[model samples]
Target: MSSDRQPIPPTRPTGHQIIAPGHTFATVSDKISSIVLTRRTPLYWFIPFLIASALLMVFLVAVTALLVRGVGLWGIKVPVMWAWAITNFVWWIGIGHAGTLISAILLLLRQSWRNSINRFAEAMTLFAVACAGMFPLLHLGRPWLFYWLFPYPNTMNVQPQFRSPLVWDVFAVSTYATVSALFWYVGLIPDLATLRDRARNRGARIIYGILAMGWRGAASHWQKYETASLLLAGLATPLVLSVHTVVSFDFTIAILPGWHSTIFPPYFVAGAIYSGFAMVLVLAIPLRAMYGLQDLITMRHLDNMAKVMLATGEIVAYSYIFEAFISWYSGDKYEMFAMWNRMTGPYAVTYWTLIFCNLVFPQILWVKKIRTNVVWLFIVSVDVLVGMWLERYVIIVVSLHRDFLPSSWGIFHPTIWDVATYVGTLGLFFFLFFLFIRGLPMISIFEVRTLLPQAEVAEVEQ
Candidate 1:
């Protein structure tokens, strides 16, 4: 009875309380601006950037080698044609989706929590897509003729054949990258203006002013800004669904047993969000600690993102299970054998790793405490991100290394070149992100300030 004494009142969080209390417009502005302006650069930032730049150099070296030697330097061969390059392309593209999902989709749904995170997420989208777009272009036999994929009228009257799924991907990815860049830039305008007005030095003021594009922050400007963002979100929501659907078509349109599934479009979309959100958490954990913005990005934000990962991860697991079931249920010998191969073939280690990392490990998140715990959540995010990469590898390589004919069967082993290229892209992504954190406001300062209660209308006028 004593232990069961009267319960305390349950409190609810209001819209204004989405941000921490006592954070005024000036406070939010100062907190975010100080990182880029007043505070000296952190050593951790320099160390990582230096390492990333070194890897970027390696990437340049590897690309030069590939161009000079042709695509023969990599381990890609007859049966294992789609190897590490395509896998990296898909993984990067999938990782890019979380940014749009957070910036556009969640905005459409009116989630206030996203206000603090969408800026960097949108930036991540643009950078990830840039990296993803590189693979297909570099894999071209004549890297110099990469522009042939575009729909421009040639002097010789040549044009890109829109009938190809590869062509569809060209449109899908380019469009996605362009919209992501514009969306990201538009979001930055107000914040850039804040930086512009607050700059103590003429150099800082001029740099930020150009980026701000003469934003006056008038009421009419706010109205137009809201309208444009809403319309862009509408345009982007379907691109998220269609881009990956086109990616899945690259496999599904094939005659191969493992590749010709009808369920691939939705499955790919779900997998994209799953991996994308994992990358978000992976970045969020480190950034939150490094920036000392724990109050701004609390456990509540982490908990909510963990829930999205859990939901999407389950969809991915279901897709995997359904693929196997359909293969068995159809009684197609090649499909059944392909499913068996995934479970027990030479690449069984990879297959089971995908299952354990994507399916099994995420199950721990069903416990609230573990999902919210910093260490556990970070580990889970890392596991899922790696698992998604393995999932892409298994899907592409395993499917190709053993197709319909036993005579054509072979193995795929990534060469030093493959590893170097992937590592190089990693460095490039971090390099761009480092520059972003150093120069621009990583968090949306104005949006965060909106989450705190504003002064009364009369008080503002006075």
Candidate 2:
């Protein structure tokens, strides 16, 4: 008997569509711009913003205390001179990587999915770098003289010690922040123009119009905008690798046993991407749910992000194993002891937990169910973040606590001040993020509009 049903035509995979169907350019713009332009703000928005503000206050208090009492307020000790401050610094820097990777490298590759998420990811980078920049300054005993880190022609003629990795960080992080800010703002121009046109109040239009810098959507304007974006993306792509690699240099160039290995550059880069993606998810999941942006963000973005976490997590896992193997294989007693100490030392619980968080927990992502499940993905993202923090703690504190001389071995415990400073940075990050989402379109209005079918049609016509 002949089947009544004709063979079903092979269908394209809908699993990774960047934007949901049935949306047009008008809807995309209205939905996104309205979030910023709405007369009445949502109750949910205020709750997190208030919490972040409170935390930002705590950060200010913590910084004030540090500046007043000096670095003595922190838990930094003799051998563990680098404690929470350095750990937080490195962690925040690493966290900034995903934004650059998603915004720049992926943009270069012409990955259309990035259009939905790149705006806030770039914001996250700027915010995280801001938080990271604060640590090194505070870590300097005389934070008042922070300008000394910069090279300038001055009366005193004090030059930053060029040999110090600390000096390199100043240049690296500053350049990263500058380029990232430009890239973020350039991307915002078109969106700002949209907001300017869409705003009802004259004041709102004036503000956005000023930021838009008189964007009229002319053909020449589009041509110039595309060129600037490409140039910035090209500049920023290397920063994704360079920033973290330079960060790794802070450890590798040192004679410290755990930090001396050549594997650190790639290892840190992989770990940065791993944690950065986790953070992106951590932010994306709640925001999407809160704003009812499911159609715009879609599970496809979440799934792709999770897959990235998995691939980077594998690399991180390999780095951990290689780190230990090299320590043992080097035949240096210091290296062997460092590895042994990490496994069986006072901070052994932290090490094992890091392993579970960075390696074991993320493995579940290989299963598609976990990758697609928002709640599970969020939890795993959090786990990876914590694991990455613990990894830094293990690398810095654990390694330093037990040095070559037994007499130098001393435990590092974070004082309340240390905890406050760290928690305060967390506050600062969220606070900036809260303000960003409220004031600007968290999703790019113009970029997301480009993902619509109409854009493709318009492009073909052009």
lDDT scores of the candidates, listed in order: 0.88, 0.90
Model 1, range 1-462, lDDT digits (tens) per residue? 134844311111236555667787788899999888888899988998899899889989989999999888888998987788889999999999999999889888878788888888888888899889888888885779988889887798988878889999988999999989999999999999999998888999999999999998998888778879888999999998899999999999888878899989999999999989888888888998999988788778889999999999999999999999999999999999998999999999999999999999999999999988989998999999899999889889999989888998998888999999888899888888888999999999877876666632323454
TM for every model, in the order presented, reads 0.95, 0.95
| Residue-wise C-alpha lDDT for candidate 2, range 246-332, written one tens digit per residue | 898899899988889899999999999999999999999999999999999899899999999999999999999999999988999
Write down the TM-score for model 2.
0.95
**Count of backbone collisions in candidate 2:** 0
How far off is residue 132 in model 2, in Å?
Answer: 0.6
The ten-residue window of minimal lDDT in model 2 covers 7-16
